[model samples]
Target: MAKITYIEHSGKRHEVEVANGLTVMEGARDNGIPGIEADCGGACACSTCHVYIDPSWVEKLPAKDSMEEDMLDFAWNPDPARSRLTCQIKVTPALDGLVVQLPEKQI
Candidate 1:
């Protein structure tokens, strides 16, 4: 399992261990991390699961696809360099201690 830290808008954080191969969005949703609405589940259709990876971990993640990139544009608080669709990031041993910061809003 990999440890993931989800920081909310209010500064509250939720940490949980998630199995490898699962997407970050699924991990947050499963662990009941507030702030990640994930309206479209893991289908990558909604930007509701958008998150900003800590700058330290940004280079460690896989590059985003065009679809995911496009969807990110619709996110509530977009951060060009760090913003990403959580559903597109698969957990892995290398990402064992991944930490993502939630935006202030998801609409």
Candidate 2:
């Protein structure tokens, strides 16, 4: 399992242990981390699951696919260098201690 940290817009933090191979969206939702709406249920069809990956961990994640990039366009206050769709991020042992910050809003 990977230990992931989800920081809400209000600075609240939720730390969770996500099984390897599970998406970050699932990790947040399963653990009830606020700010990750996951409206499309990990289908990569919505931007509600958006999160800003900590700069230190950004390069460790897989590059965003075209679909994810497109969806991010609709995210609130998108940050090209940091924004990511949690549904597109698969947890792995290498990603232990991942930190993601939620936007002020999802819609």
Candidate 3:
């Protein structure tokens, strides 16, 4: 399992243990971490699952596909350098200590 930390906009933090092969969005949702709506249910079709990867872990993740990039445009206050759809990030042992920060809003 990979341990992921999720920081909310107000600085609240939630640490969750996620099984490999699941997506980051699943980690957040399964753990009931607030702020990730996951309206599309990890389908990568909506931006409600948007999150900002901690800079240190950004390079550890795979590059975003055009679909994710396009969906991110709908995220609230999207950061070109840090914005990512959690549904697009597959959990792995290599991401054991990953951290992601949630935005102020998701709609």
Candidate 4:
């Protein structure tokens, strides 16, 4: 399992262990971490799970696909270089220290 951290805009933090093959959104959702609405339930069909990956981990993650990139256009205050949809990120041992920050609100 990978240990991931979700930092809310208010400065609260939730660090959880996520099993391999599960998405980051699932990690947050299962742990009852707030901020990732995941309205579409990991289907990549919504922007509610938008988050900004820590700068150091940005290059470590897989590049966003066309569908995710397009959906990010509707995310709240997205950062061109750091924003990602939690649902699209799969957890693995390689991402053991992954950290993501939640935006103030979802759109």
Point to the candidate with the largest lDDT: 4
TM-score per candidate: 0.97, 0.98, 0.98, 0.98
lDDT of 4 by residue, 17-53 (tens): 9999999999999999999999999999999999999
Query: Candidate 3 regions off by >4 Å?
Result: none
Residue pairs with colliding backbones in model 2 are none
lDDT tens digits, residue span 8-69, model 3:
99999998899999999999999999999999899988899999999998888999999999
The parts of candidate 2 lying over 4 Å away from their true place are none
lDDT of 1: 0.92
lDDT of the structure predicted as candidate 3:
0.94
**Residue 60 Cα positional deviation in candidate 4, in Å, after optimal superposition:** 0.2
lDDT measured at residue 58 in model 3 versus the true structure, 0 to 100: 84
lDDT of each: 0.92, 0.95, 0.94, 0.96
By the TM-score metric, which is better: model 1 or model 4? 4
What's the residue-level lDDT of 12 in candidate 4? Answer: 96
Our tally of clashes for model 3 stands at 0
Backbone clashes (count) for model 4 = 0
By TM-score, how accurate is candidate 4?
A: 0.98
List RMSD in Å for every model shown: 0.7, 0.5, 0.6, 0.5
Clashing pairs in 4: none
